[model samples]
Target: MDMDIQPPRRTFIRQMAASGALLGVAGLSGCTASGVAEEVAPGFRHGVASGDPLADRVILWTRVTPAHDGEGDVAVRWQLATDAAMRQVIAHGSVVTSAQRDYTVKVDAAGLLPGHVYYYQFAVDGGDKSVVGRTKTLARGDAKQVRLAVFSCSNYPAGYFNVYADAARQDNIDAALHIGDYIYEYESTGYACGQAEALGRVSEPRDVLLRLEDYRRRYAQYRADPDLQAVHAAMPFIAVWDDHEFADDTWRDGSVDHKTSQYGPFELRKHAALTAYHEWMPIRVPDASAPDKIYRSFDFGGIVSLHMLDTRLIGRDQQLMLSSYYDEHRRFDVEKYKHDVCSPRRQMMGHEQMAWLEEQVSRSTARWQMLGQQVLMARMEYPTAVVMGECSPTNYCALKKRAEADPSCVNEKEQRWLSAQTLPCYLDSWDGYQADREQVFAMMRKHRKNLVVLAGDTHNAWASDLRDAEGRQAGVEFATASVSSPGMEGGYPGRDPDDVAAMMVDLIEPLYYAQTSKRGYMIVTASHEQVRCDWRFVDTVFQHEFTAATERSLRVLPGPGNRRIEECYG
Candidate 1:
């Protein structure tokens, strides 16, 4: 057995207690007790996970609970086998985990064949074994097809992770792609926690996550969920962090929700958050010194080149709020807003990352170029009236009825409002950084690659045409709904969800499909000829017993002749 050692456990425990984390652990049911009782013993309670798979290697991860308070580093043994029964052991190793890494064990199990399935598990030196986990390696050369399960925005207190459970049962999926927001940073009574008390899904710590221990405990709570664990155990995950992983609307310097007076320093909080994220997630860090540089590419056996990007924290400028452009009279200055938004100095993916992406896209020889990213990249422009809250669905319907009844009854202001000029609804998306978006479009057009953008921050399902500023179609975008977060229906209190969705599609030109109220995920299938995306939704996340159904299916063909999205028919 191989043993890896760290600093003294007593010193680490004292530091953790000083941070108030040790005191809060007792109230959190998700956290396992350190003291060994008669009924319970120290074991692998958080389950196993695998991620960031390459052609020859995959990351295996698990956590070991301490049997007693004074325990030092724990030695864990892991095995990788070709079969589930562990008869054909191909790789085995031992590693030591201590409080320094939150007792989480992560090993890069290499020496595996390309596109092969492997089962892995971990056990303490003399303890019981953990549940078996299955993972697959990326294909190296030619491949017929590739399928990926796309997910985002999984808030623990909002509801159960039924979307993950449903995706776990999918046998054909090669890997799982989590675009962002794998965990929320809110307290027990924050965003989308109205039903948390009734569902008994209160967040651990019961306070907002600001320290390293707080973030680690939150991840532990999420990993403890059977549904989340099942999905992680079923397939290797390729993930990136969004704003919620740190704080709401996090940028480079700070977050919108963070106050330096209360949190001490934003940098300290961010470092703590990143440290916990690295320790908890099964990701291969790009750079040990610079952890924020997470943008990288993965080639899927020449079929698809998946480029996972970091758009939130890397090179993003402070988001431009549309409300800031309003006057004292509550009138919006469309021209001034447009001029400021189109400034060429603004950036979304920063200079270094953008240059890297351009080089990668230009040189890739794969059949499909898929961008796995966070915000909506397509044009989601809505009418000015609709965006400014001047016109709701109910109001629009009533005005239409009145206009049909008597043409003269409708006034000029109403007509102008109805035909209001269109603008981007959320400035935090690519819409705010128009110059950067144009640069990307120019690169795609120059390369003439088969582009497919996968986005998932809105918590609502969307399918849109990727077009340039001049209205030339570049590709297509498939934005998945959140795994558990509420959608647009939550904003519009009384309007029907279907009506809101229909209204959005009618107003937004590039939008082809929309599901305003549903908790679901997307299954993207890529081939040489075409790429298809199926939006699958669960009936309810309030209960464990739920049924899933395909809400919509859309496909985009390769080449210039078919850059637009069309209904996928049998």
Candidate 2:
């Protein structure tokens, strides 16, 4: 299959104006033929979208400009049809993309049947219309089969979205799970990408995006990429934004280093980011005005009940104070905040989400229950030795972040995790927030569902058997990995550094298998007997060429715990 982007369609504005029934923002150009509620041509910056599949309904979305209000609240019409050509309109509706939602449109096209594909599109006067969108509904429990393309961490500037392009080309997939990091927050660092980089891809939006316009521009750049567009066109997506959806490591109160007052109320930007995210992707919003609450669940006909969790919004805490947590001993400063767990009051998922998750996990009856989440859920116990020994957590460690060969490299003097010698580890993640993580695990215990988590954020691929607090494996396994942004191995001038990724995994504890140098998406196939995931990679990415290939991999419980590597597949 070809992965190529054809030239843009000629501007169809004139014909659009003559479509005879232009239902534009104002109706047509606000600059009327002769005054009279002059019709303003609707804008079409953001592309079309359709999501939230129930047995009988789906939500369709779009945004309109009044040929004015760079961000307008123009009125427009939306239609969902049974045919791709819109020759037979089934359900239709209208919405105003007013200044309120940055002029975006979202409407739930309900009362449809299950296990069927549908065509949808939006239009305005002057004949302007969005590209046709295709969507499908979830099959009921007894439906034969369902497939999903799992993904996360798409840093546009880091490399080409060729993995997405490749995944889109595959056949028989039911839907795509956009785990998060859908867009990077970084602006261009002219020197940070391209040939000298790990991935041979460069970001077009190479600048920090903060305002409504900046954000809009970035999405346009990403959506324009052929590979990304192909994936969206290929399947309906179930998406939930991670912190990058707003700002890196962002939480309810603040960000890692973001100035509080400079960016307006975190809530305002959060709402804007949510709006733009929903507008540009093939997903729906719960409501137009308060779309920040886009988290929801969907079942693909009983084979699996997929719960998409929101790890950033609602109740997340600003990332742990890493600096304060760092002790002069060059170790995790356990004494710095003795017994002070980042308050349970300090949450990752808000109260509403926590309760909702428990309810969903409690009620799910699918033979295999899947949680599409962000962040590492398993307890990662790296020997204090790894970070303190040959491994340095920083690109250049000042003692720690400095180069490995510097004459003053103190880490080299330390011994590995041998008898009397032990590695000092850090305290963050589920380890740091054991109480909260326990709640999730406890919920899993209460339910009989066989759980599997698909995650992203840390630009590394990992496979592990997840256990609840009591040490009983939740019968859940996680297939989480690195960014489409950059590789975990960083810049190591080498032919190919497979050993680096392997070494890091070997050094870190509780990890069954991993690959940090490669970049790609996973294809998961499950049946009553086993759930299989293939980690496919693109050999090259920087130069807009697709050479993605799956070198090797691992798997987890086949309807039961103790994961074993499939020697043949391995």
Candidate 3:
């Protein structure tokens, strides 16, 4: 591994600990041994959360903020109960959290029955107790259904997190699958964040986040939202991060948005962002040997198996920039573009991860295979006419300006090609990694798998057929709209979102449905027979009212019975 990208274990661990991961359970060992623990701070204010549910284990988390600022460490006690009233304490423990770990406490409560519901709470010694949170463990054997409330791209300053509130109220959600872009890195400015002023939402710090404190403060601000807190308190979440968690369009080594000269060292900044992510999230630390091992598999009995992939940070290469390509060639070279850009050497999931994914798929005994990841998987080709017709003049003007800024687009051949077609793919998405996409499809075919891909980061709802080069259907994808971030409709100001959605579906053969302007999440139900997804949209996020509608319901049955997704009305 690149030391710049991934540091050594002991060094990295110590760095994180000093930065905030300095959590020591030994500090509370005396109180626990004596059976008398004391809480040093106020009660939980960030709310309680649970995640990474296994057959017999689940990780529980909560933060203990003192009544006064600048307090040091707090020893908080937590208890898990079978009943909501906390009278039936099944599992309990005391942990030490200091200013280093940002006063957050996490406990992995094991030795629980599978598919069982448990309630938990944290209390300060001689102080107050947190609100009880309900969590469920993953089923052990054959589960009738695995319901996942899928969410992503929740920009704190863009609007309200009404979708999170709505998901909290939902009774059937087994686990919340957050496919990244959990928090944005941009500041609360017009040029950086699009809708902060328009939505009347202000992110804390009021500027770009650079230091660890800034990232922690941002997490605090977001978690402070009642809707977001409600969702965390209600259900366990399986999350994977996307680009905005660190910076815009980030990859393994660097980011398009960051300049080392201005931002200091890239490695330091990345380490800070990742450390905060680990501290705030209710996730288990990956293997110390690997370090960057967020990509893991979860078995939901024999019915479904979820493969939560890390598509952004772990191994992704830098995105292909069309301007850069054009500038290099001094004109549009179709053959060169296809050769260089579509080469098999270009990888999305690095070699080790790819092998691991393939091995996991082959070893999976579940009836349905689900890939919970970021970005769209389906092929999206853009012809210039369709782009011109659907997109606003401002969009064309931006493109025109970009072309003007590049030396290649000034030439006649490049200009002609630009007039004829806008590059047929979004370089930031899976469309840019055709060779990798083909490899995945080949793996799917070889394993004869029944796949259901869960995607986010586009900030728009999409239902597409995952087809191979021969147009053979490999799986079905349900890409969710954002929890609050702006979508395709927001990108194209004057055009109707509905019309844009319709146009996209029309333009892309595999894409069957699209909802470009809604802000909400997806509810996916998986069973032995089929995996169904309900694309739900909230009426608005600027208010507290939970007004929602099922935008569409799409389902795909496994195996030879069904290969394509069908609209499920009932």
Looking at candidate 1, what is the lDDT of residue 422? 78
Per-residue CA lDDT of model 1 for 1-570, tens digit only, reads 111122122332234335432222232343442212223455766778899999999999988766664468988999999876667999999999998888889999998999999888888866667777889999987678999999999998899998987887775688999999999999888999999989878888789999998998888888777678777878899999999999998887888999999988989988998998888889999888999888989899998999999999989998988889989999888898988778899999999999999999999999888999999999888777777887875677667668879979989988987666778858888999899988988898999888899999999999999999899998999999999999898788897888889877777789999998999999999988889999989888999878788778899999889878998878
**Candidate 3 structure quality by residue, lDDT tens digits, 99-132:** 7988888899999999998888898876677767
Question: Which is the better candidate, 2 or 3, if ranked by TM-score?
Answer: 3
Residues 1-570 of candidate 2: C-alpha lDDT, one tens digit per residue? 222242222222123224422232333224221111123455453455566677887767665645554444466888877776578988887776676655567777788889888877778866878756677888887777677777888876666676876775676777778788887766567423554245433444446667666676667556545466445645677888887777877777666645657766666666667667866665765556766666678887777788887777666665555456666776665444434453555566778888988887778777677788777776665544444444453222233323345544444343222222222233334455556777876676667557777777777677766765456776544454443667655665563566666555555445567777777777776665556777767765566555655554544444444433342242
- Per-candidate Cα RMSD to the true structure, in Å, reads 8.7, 7.7, 10.9
Compare the candidates by lDDT and give the number of the best one.
Answer: 1
Residue pair clashes in candidate 3: 20-100, 39-125
In terms of TM-score, the best-performing candidate is: 1
When sorted by lDDT, best at the front, the candidate numbers are: 1, 3, 2
Which 10-residue window in model 1 sums to the lowest lDDT?
1-10
> Which structure is stronger by TM-score: 1 or 3?
1
- TM of each candidate vs. truth: 0.91, 0.79, 0.86
